[model samples]
Target: MDQHIAEAIGRPDLIHLDERLVCLRFETMKVVSALAAVRHLLDTGAVRRGDTLLDSSSGIYAYALALACHRYGMRCHIVGSTTVDRTLRTQLAVLGATLEQMEPCSDLKLDQKRRVERIHEILLHHPEYHWMRQYHDDIHYLGYRTVADRILRAVGTRSLTVVGGVGSGASTGALARHLRTAGPGADDVELVGVQPYGSVTFGAEHVTDPEIIIAGIGSSIPFGNVTHELYDTLHWVSFDAALVGSVDLLRRHAVFAGLSTGAAYLAARHERARSPERTVLFVAADTGHRYADTVHARHEEAADITGLAPQEVSDLSELALPWSRMHWNRAPAPAPAPRA
Candidate 1:
């Protein structure tokens, strides 16, 4: 018998796209990570059989926590946004996860805060429920260690650069930290973070770009799990670029992934182009099957990114980012430097 659903969580596919790049494809990456967190809570005696699990998610994490709770015989609650689509709600319903969505906000930042506020209300009313603190807790970081190990074993003796969405800081931040210590050519491995155009984390002007549709990679608020030191460089990818990458990924590799995955794919391509010698690894967090129409109607390939002005570069030493206010520590940028 398959005694544990949690056993099915880790060891997602690591596909070598080419000599220079690979994709860490997951049916849902957070399912793997959330399982780790839940297991830790259980083993540490933080919670028992009767206790309930709770967290706030825009979408993915809610499904993940629900799945984890269902497998572990625990109850789950999700504080979500109005953006919580019918599909996800149905999945959560079947999984027996309760979702309370906050009022819709025209601005994403306000929406996130409202969700947090709702979580507070839920916690106050039901003080017995354990909050997973997906944004603020380090336990979420521990989940990605398995992924880092997988990357290490797959690309032994090669230079590597890990790039992906930095939402809540848990996935990319945690994965990069582990990869740094144990990955091949550990000393030289580069860690790059990708964010949306207006995510407060990267300090792009708070004015949300209508074109940037990727989520789960950037945030309106600073996430505790996203440690600034873990990243060597950061790129703020626009939605158009992410869409381009997403569609291209489907066409070239038949890898169906979400907007965040596309954004990460875009960043990975940028990294690979900058240094063809080093291997690039990026995660495709979820299936793009839901996005069937997003790229299928158009058949033309995405344009090549020039890596020019307004493009995200590693050196904030020269660029003035609103979030960093020029306080971010500087690192000399890797070569093939973009001309001013």
Candidate 2:
């Protein structure tokens, strides 16, 4: 599976997963990120000799843009949040991309609208910069489609329950479009989207006071990539559940995934319980190493159903498995040593 995915991205180290859902084996984000940027430039006719491109990104997207800028010989300017990883920032700077950090929100809340506004302001200050606004770009979807294609091939079945969280919703929307237009067989696949409980934007009922921990999952406003018409169903997960899912993945599967991936996994399990016969595929967006200080720090907290501050939850060792018993760690014991 990794070999196939590597070939698609033209990088042998482009995939992180092995046959078993354990710790990541490679760094595929770099490949996918670059693919997204390059694909966007190609499809939009935005690429030009010495064209200066600007992007507002946190970390993963910034890495991609840096790679794209280097490959295309375009001057790149990245508007990033103060919370972005230092390693990523250093790498982007080392790649000759200009880095600008936006001040943290006064309310201590990281709002997408505010981030976009800040980036817009930066662009205004530098009129020469051409913003590759991800929210409005159709080509971003093409980059994410590669992931969906890999999922389809991995399962070796056309009928699947595709599940993932929606940050910008480009990936989910692209998967939906691919399934819908591919043919009669495509109809068998269902796309399930997961959103944070507090920031449910797509027909989800619950909405709590906003918090900034879950970085790549929530949005303040509907994006062009999120087409309700394409989604089959949407699931809302609490911060606590998402945290438990993250810890559970680490303890059981050895898959150190981010909170958004955990949220999506929880949603997938919920869907799987309703339809156990279907093959389920979910995206592991990134590793948890990046968020060790935040989500991973308070992972053992009790499952809080009430929409309160996450810190209020008490630490509990045994997590109540809300979904199923199919944990990552419960692999079957090897067959008993063969007798004579």
Name the top lDDT candidate.
Answer: 1
| Best-matching candidate per TM-score | 1
Clashing pairs in 1: none
With a 3 Å backbone cut-off (N, CA, C), the pairs that clash in candidate 2 are: 252-328, 252-329
lDDT of candidate model 2 versus the reference: 0.59
CA error at residue 185 for candidate 2, angstroms: 1.9
Candidate 1 per-residue C-alpha lDDT over 108-190 given as tens digits, one digit per residue, 9 for 90 to 100: 77888888888888889999999999988989988888778778888743578887887888888787778777734676777
List the global CA lDDT of all models: 0.75, 0.59
Worst 10 residues of 1 by lDDT: 321-330
Alpha carbon lDDT at 229, candidate 2: 58
Q: How much is 23 displaced in model 1, in angstroms?
A: 0.7
